[model samples]
Target: MWYSISNLLGFGADFGPTTAAGRLLTIGFWMLSLILIATYTAQLTSFLTLKASKSTITGIDDIKNNKVPHSRIGIVIGTSAEEYFLKTISQGSTNYYHLSTTQDIFIKLLDNSIDVAVASGASAIYAINNLYCKLTLVGEPFYATSIAIDLPRVWQYKQSLDVQILQLTESGELERISAKYFNTLTCGSSSSDESSSKKMEVQSLAGLFLTYACVSVIAILLHLWLKLKRHL
Candidate 1:
């Protein structure tokens, strides 16, 4: 049944479902399968591309200021860096192009389609030293994040995975991977002055919210107190 849907939807060209109902049921499965496949494929490609170009990216801010050329920067769609760069950094750079696979980005870089690439700095470091690409950090770091291994929730494997990941992190394997590609001195530094400004903005916003909430509570309490005194 699912095989028929795969055939009708042009999903699994290699396999076919025997029943019509099975094919219909497969429509949903096929759609989900396609989505997952594309996502995984993009990740795999991105990893390969990052591996190839980690040495060449230079740093995060170069891509923002058009220092790397508008056509040269590579970024994955829907990634946090992509969102931050497009919304906050690459304001006037019309030459920028969005890429899905990191592998494609690196290929483009190698082919001279792009001059710089941005991804997780940690992954960039891993690719740089191990991949042996000729590249260097162009400027300061961009954003920072910690990586964790996600395990299946079935049978309560979270604790085991956490321990294993902690061991890997504590043993310095993670740092070792980072030290290979990135300049150990500034691997995770924020690339732009604006980042500091953003931090200020966030703090200010938090303060404003807290103040407003407190004022609202005080006003409500005062109104209730006045109403009770009148009743008395």
Candidate 2:
């Protein structure tokens, strides 16, 4: 475990496997680590750079500034999001496209009728992660709001729950949880359609597992054979 962690972090290991089979296994592990790290780094960098591009309409501010025409923006009618857009973005004019449901966001986006969609960040993210893998968050959630479980006021465990949630965020468990659901790109376009990158699965490391299994069996068999030789 120490060796694996150190290798991934680029720290020099104090010692390495001495046996031939152990060395072979270590080599395979090194290769796997490199591939995993490279993929993660490349994708992270790509996302960050894309986030900075001016061509992308980022947040509510961009919409208010008319980066996309008001007619091209889709807002779910009768939603607080629509109200906010009307009051803040469109100056009380109902010129923006009225969408019937959150689902209309993706439908309008894909159909080329809308350049932007006004919906809760959570709803948009959920759609992007589960249903519409090609769709994505443009910027930090605007009009950020807190969501909470319905706990009784003066609840004794409230502090404890808050602490636990904060710990999850600080330790990156939240991001890991998010990644588990959001990692796949089943719906893709052109280049991504041809080659969608996915996290390394256990199946991809079958060769390494097979090698270790074979080595363990060989070692056991050799031990038994040596015992028989000594008896003879």
RMSD of each: 27.9, 16.2
Can you give the TM-score per candidate against the true fold? 0.43, 0.43
Superposed on all Cα atoms, model 2 deviates from the true structure by an RMSD in Å of 16.2
Report residue 26 deviation for candidate 2 (angstroms): 45
Global lDDT scores for all candidate models = 0.57, 0.72
Candidate 1 per-residue lDDT over residues 5-26, each given as its tens digit: 5543554657654544334445
